[model samples]
Target chain A: MEDVEAQTHLIGDSGEDPIISKIALAEVQRAIDSLPQEQREVLALVCGEDLTYREAAEVLNVPIGTVMSRLARARRRLVEMTAAA
Target chain B: MSELHLTDEILMAFADGELDQPVAAAVARVMAQDPAVARKIVEFQQSRRLTRSVFANNLAPDVPSELRAAISAKIEAYEAAVEGGEGKQAKETKSIWGGGMSPVRMALAASLAAVAVSAAYFIGQHSQSEVGRLAQLEHPRVLQELSRLESGRDAELPFGRLRVISTYRLPDNSLCREFRLQSTSTSTDAVACRTDGWRVTFALSDPAKGAEYVPSSGGDLLESYLDNLGAGNPLEGEAEAKALSETAR
Candidate 1:
């Protein structure tokens, strides 16, 4: 019975307007959390900070190309994870 | 060049406007001719938008160092509390979050697939295997069928055979399917709703082992759960198909 109530509560949440937005945000965060730490860090620096590849490389103390490749992989993985979910 | 293979890095760089003008122009020309290439660019752009939207608040000083510092500070504080004592653990921490979250905590704050997680906790409280039965109902095979299985049809799932009884909406208009699962040992009558996924909202197993659940038509657990659910009319034909398609996600 309690389980039924909890399930009802979750289902009720699914119908509200934030269902899509909040659920998508959750999906994205979960996807990001599953990324490799290096990929996650690179993603944070690039997308979260709006940093250019070169600037991000300078901050991370890596070559500019490393930033590009990592960001590419991270972006691709995000697409795959979100779509699969 | 007449043709250039576009790698993800090249497309991403093009999307970010980080490529040289000549290269960017070339990529644009190619994208104009190739829908696949253009779609990749859009995806890269969308991925950037999504990451920024969710992660912007988590980054302090808009740097990776802030995340690293927060993680380390939390770990050190936890360790100090374990070793030195609670008194010294209250010392000033460098995390911009004050008491920063662990990665697990961060993800928890974002979202948890609560059904499965809580099922584990409920296992201890509930006698003998009820939660296990509930958790087992979440198999992809079950959901795949739930999204398409109609009343006249039956599905042979990995764990059991399934028969969908009806399709309807809850008070809040969440799509739901009532189904019965008959394994070799026991039969389950359950209501599944499309939320984050097709989750079983409530279930009652028959004590009649190896027999399909016997319906009383009244005063049963299944009936009781539905009593106040404010169920809408049972969907059928195109409507049922449309509702199930939404649950496919």
Candidate 2:
């Protein structure tokens, strides 16, 4: 039971800053929160799987240019929000 | 260096590894040396990692037995409805899922319908001078095919062409469509649809995989094409039959 409980709550033994993790989590949430559904999806797919622009474009059924445009827009929003915070 | 105004999309794409090697390399050089852009990139990456961790556990959680049972029941009901022989009309009515449709299956049904309706007539219509005149008749056809495929299960429909290998509907109303292009490794397939056409979307392909799904924009734009045709409220009688007539060929 003790071993099982420890395993369940484990965040790994790395002593890295929880503060950075917290910041990252907050930033990601914020970036995605205000985004239109399509932008949020683009962020999720591009970021989540690390796909290339062409790949993302094909999967999303948009032109590569559109994919680039959306990513650019999404990134700008994140930067602005982070700056505001 | 001219201020290097990094757009959010470029920075995100860079962070997400979406840029091509040459372009990506160029961006990398800029990011490494450019303080403002680098800082922006890190923030987004951090967010991605955090959000993923937050919901990663949900991916593995056992779908509630009741929810699973409900889905199973829906599937059985759908099958029974199909077997009843209402044909294409019945399929569309049964498959036209709005709030009631499963998100995962909705995209498959919707995309299948979209692809079928949009592809058949529209493929030849483009680059033709008569494109504008044909648009009026084409829109209804897409909707009708969706209904027919959804309700009637037409033998001539292209739903059978594309193979839907897997599907999943998140607790949230996001429908995922995963398919392999018919008879071609060169083509890859995926689409995500929302409650209304307002939110219909697709995934990005794998860059290394090349143009896996080189989709021709069918007759209508895949995302916006379904705008008028919400689930359940399919075109009726002749309108529905006329729409599906092209696919029967």
> What share of the reference contacts is kept in model 1?
0.41
TM-score of every candidate = 0.40, 0.33
Considering every candidate listed, which one attains the maximal lDDT?
Answer: 1
Candidate 1 local Cα displacement, residue B50, angstroms: 0.6
Model 1: per-residue Cα lDDT over B16-71, one tens digit each: 75766556656654553455676677567657756755553353223356666754
lDDT of 1 at A16: 34
Residue B48 shift from truth in candidate 2, angstroms: 3.5
User: Where does candidate 1 stray beyond 4 Å?
Assistant: A1-18, B59-249
- For candidate 1, write residues A9-71 as lDDT tens digits: 221121234444555556677788778877887787667645557656766778998999988
Backbone clash numbers for all candidates listed: 0, 28
| Regions of candidate 2 where Cα sits further than 4 Å from its true position | A1-20, A23-27, A79-85, B1-8, B54-249
